[model samples]
Target chain A: MANFPENIVPSEMKNFRISIDDFIEAYNKGEAELVDIRVPMETKVWQVNFGLKIPANELPKRLDELPKDKLIAVACPHTDRSNMARVYLAEQGFNVKYLVGGLLGLMERLKGGMAKDINL
Target chain B: MKEISFDDYLKSFDYDERKAMKIKLNEMLKLYEEGKAEIIDIRFKDEYEAWHLGFGKNIPLNELPNRIDELDKNKTIVTVCPHYDRAEIARLFLKLKGFNARYLTDGLLGTVDYLRGDKARDYIAKIKGES
Candidate 1:
C-alpha cells in the first residue's frame, strides 16, 4: 500500500473509506461514474456496464475530460494503479473517490449471490 | 540476459516472491457467500468453458487488458489458473497497472473441491446464480 503523511488532511478526509455497497448504491441510482484505469487490452475479456477507459498513465493529461462536479469513482484491474491515481487526484485538489479493493472487490461482492441486489 | 543492479533487484523483490492468497478453500467459500470476494478463472476461453470453478469470472489473462472495463473496481479480485503462475503474472501486471489483485492459491480445481462438499454447496449455489 502507498504510505500517506500522518497529517495529510483533516480527520474526516483522511479517514474517508468507500465500500462496495456504497458504489453499488450510487451506480443503481445513476449518481456515480465508474472509470476503468486499466489499459484497453486489459478490458477486452471482462468489463462493467457504463465503465469508461482512461488508462492510469493518461489520467493526468485527460483530467479535463472528466466531470469534475460529479462523484467519480476510479478503478483498475487491481487497486495499486487506482490508489496511485486517487492519491494523485487528491493532491491536485480534485475530490475523486477510488473503489476499494478494485475490480476484485466488486466481483467478490457480486459472487456471493448479491448480483441482482447490486445497487447499480 | 543483461546485468542488473542490486537496487533494481531489491525493488522487484515482491514480484519475485509473489505467492497465492493463503486462505483456505472453505474460507473462500464463506467469503463468496458473504459477497466479500469473487473467484476469477484466468484460463483461456476454451479451457475455461470445458470446466471451471462454477463461480469465477472467465477472464483470460492475455485478454484482460482489453476487457478490463467490465470489472467492478470496488470489489476484491482473486485470479485462478491451472497452477498459479499465470495468475501471479497477471496479479503483478495488475499491481503495476494499479489494481488490488491477488492470485488464488487453490486454482480452479480447488474451488471445485470445496464446492463438492455439503458445507460449500450453498456457497457454490450462490456463485452459480451470480455467474
Candidate 2:
C-alpha cells in the first residue's frame, strides 16, 4: 500500500493561519502569493486587482499554476474556504496559510486613500 | 464522499450563469417561511455567535462531514455566510451529499440589511405563526 501523510499536528496548525497585515508584508516582499478562492460570480461582482483567481473547487486540478517556493495565502471573503484550501495545498506538499479574516479584512485595510500602501 | 468533480462545479458556472443553483435573500426568506427551504449558516461557531440571522442551524464548514444527518433532504438547503464564498463551498458539498442545496447569493449581510423595518416584522410574524 502507498504511504499517505498524517494530519498536521496541533503545534504546526498555529503556523497555518496568517494575518492580513503579515500577508501584505510578505506579499510586498514577493515572498507570499495570494489565491482568491471565491467563485467566478462573486469575483465578477468584486475583486482585487492582483492575486491568482482559482476558485476553491478548481484548486485540485489547477495546482500546477501555483509556485512551490513562495508562501501561498488562500483567501475567500472570510477564512473558512481559505482554511480548507490551505489544508488541501499543505497536503499536496506546498507551503500555504489561510489568510486570517480573509480578503474582506484586506479590503478594509486597503480601503480609501490607503490602497497604495500595499505594493502589490 | 461522493465522486463529484470540479467539472460539475465548473458546469454550474459555465451554463446559464448559475441562476439555477443560487438563491436570493427574498426568495430564501419566502421559501424558508413556507417550509420549502432550510437555511444552513456555515460559519464558525465564534463568527455565528458574533452575529447570526436567528434562523437555521449553525453548522461550521469543518463540522459538516460529521453532521450531514441534521440536514433535511426534503427541503432546499440554502447555505449562507456573511458573503457567498463559504456558502457556495458548503452548497457544493451539500449538493454532493445528495441534498437539494443552493448558495445564498445576496448573502447574510445583505439579508440583514434587507430585513429591517416592516420586512423583518412580516417575516418574523410568519415564522411565529408557523411555530
Candidate 3:
C-alpha cells in the first residue's frame, strides 16, 4: 500500500520492496543488511548508521562489496535509484529488497515522532 | 468530601518503583544491536500501523499470550507501548510465563520527548561514559 515513486517501473524480480516494519524486524534480528545507493553529498547530510554506502553509479563495479550472508535492503533518497539497484541486484542473484519509501520516508517517520534511530 | 487517603500519597512512590523496573533506552539498544534482546511493540494494530520503532515485532497486548510462542526463549524481550503502563503489564505477564523480558520504562512517547529535546547522543554518551 506504499506509494512508490512514479519514475520507477515495476519489476518482475522475486525480491521486491520492504516495509519499514519488516526492515526494522530484519535489522534488529541481524538477518538483514542495508545499502544506501545515494551519492556522497546526499549521504553526507545524513544516513542510517548501520547502512553501507554504495553510490548507484558505482554499484556494478563494486557489487562484490555487498555481503552475501544477509538480505540486502537497498535505499536512496527516494525509491528511484534504489529500485534500479533492486532490479540489478536481483538479476545478479543477490537477495535484495528496495526500501519501499527510501530514506526520505525514514526521515519523515523519524521527524513525525515514530521511533528514533537506534543510535547516533 | 470523600476521605483523601495515605494510599493516594503513596501512589507516586509506587509509580517510581514501576519506572525503576524499566530498561534504559541505551542499554536496551546495545543489547538489541548485539542480538541479545528483542523489542516487541504491544500496542494495537492500528496504533502500531500509525508509528513504531524501526526494530520490533507488533504483537498487540491483547494478542500476546496467543502469540507468545513466536518470541525466542533465550533472548531478552523488551516490551513497548505508547506509555509504560501496557508494556509493564506485558513484561510482567511474559516474566510469569518464563520469558526473559523488560518494559521500556517511559515507553515510545518518552523516546519521542528525548529526541525532540535532542538528548539522544548525550544520553548514549553518558551511559557509555564517553561524555
Candidate 4:
C-alpha cells in the first residue's frame, strides 16, 4: 500500500486547485504541464488531443518523465482523481495543482471556434 | 487483449442491463460475508486514506487496469465510490473486461449510513464470531 499523502492540512490545500481559465492562460505561455490521468478504458472513449498521457496508477514509476520546472497540472475527466494525484505529487515535492473543472471541462471550454485561443 | 468494445456494451443496454448492473447495499454486505463477493472501493488512494468503509479493498478507478489480477473471478465483484457515478464507471469497465461485476446503487456513503451504531457493531460481531 502507498503511504498516505502529507497534504491533508488546510494551509497546504489552499493552492491545491486551478481554474480552467488560468490553466489555459498558462498553457499559452507554456508555463504549465498538463498530465491527463485517465485510465485506458476511459481514454478509449474520449480523450484530449494534447498533454502528457500518464495514467495516475503508473505515476510513481514515471516521475522522471515529468518536468520539475513547470507547474504540473494534473487532470482526469472530473476533479476526483486529479485531486488524489495532486496530493501524491505534492508530497513528492513537485509544484502541482489540479484543474478545478477537470479535463471534461477543459475540452468543453475549447469547443466550437474557441479552440484558436490556445492555438489549437 | 480488449475482450469487449464500448459500442457492444452500449448496444446491449436496456432494462435487464440496468437490473444486472447494480447490487443493493444489503445484498452486497450479505454476499461479502458469505465469501461470494469482493467489494472494491474505486476511489483514489488519498480519498481512501481520508476515510473509508473499513472493509473491502481500496483500488482507485485509474488503477483498475493494473490491479485486475488481484480480483477473484469466482466471486461477484462489486464496485463502490462516494456516490454511484464512479462506481458505475468501474462496474462497466469490469463487466466489459469479463468480470461478473456490479455497482453499489445506493453508494458507499449510503452503505455507511445504513450500518451505523448498533447495526454496525452487530454486523461486525456476527462476521467475526462466525469466522
DockQ comparisons of all candidates to the true complex: 0.01, 0.12, 0.01, 0.03
Q: TM-score per candidate, in order?
A: 0.43, 0.62, 0.40, 0.52
Ranking 1 against 2 by lDDT, winner? 2
Instruction: Report clashes for each candidate as comma-separated counts.
Output: 38, 0, 0, 0
User: Which digits, one per residue and each the tens of the lDDT, describe model 1 over residues A4-54?
Assistant: 222233234323336678878877787777788776567787787666787
Runs in model 4 with CA error above 4 Å? A1-120
Q: Mind giving the per-residue lDDT tens digits that candidate 1 earns over B9-69?
A: 2244332232332345566666666777766776677787787664658877667776666
Whole-model Cα lDDT of every candidate shown, in order? 0.61, 0.77, 0.68, 0.78
Q: Which residue pairs come into collision in candidate 4?
A: none
Question: Which segments of candidate 1 are over 4 A away from where they belong?
Answer: A1-6, A9-16, A111-113, A118-120, B1-131
Q: TM-score of chain A, model 3?
A: 0.78
Better of 3 and 4 by TM-score: 4
Ordered from best to worst TM-score, the candidate numbers read: 2, 4, 1, 3
Residue by residue across A9-65, what tens digits does model 3's lDDT show? 213322467876788778777888889987777778886777799876667678789
Query: What's the true lDDT of residue B29 in model 3?
Result: 72
**Ordered list by lDDT, greatest first:** 4, 2, 3, 1
Q: At residue B3, give the lDDT of candidate 2.
A: 39
Q: Which ten residues in a row have the lowest lDDT in candidate 3 chain A?
A: A1-10
| Model 3 interface RMSD, one decimal | 22.9
Best by DockQ: 2
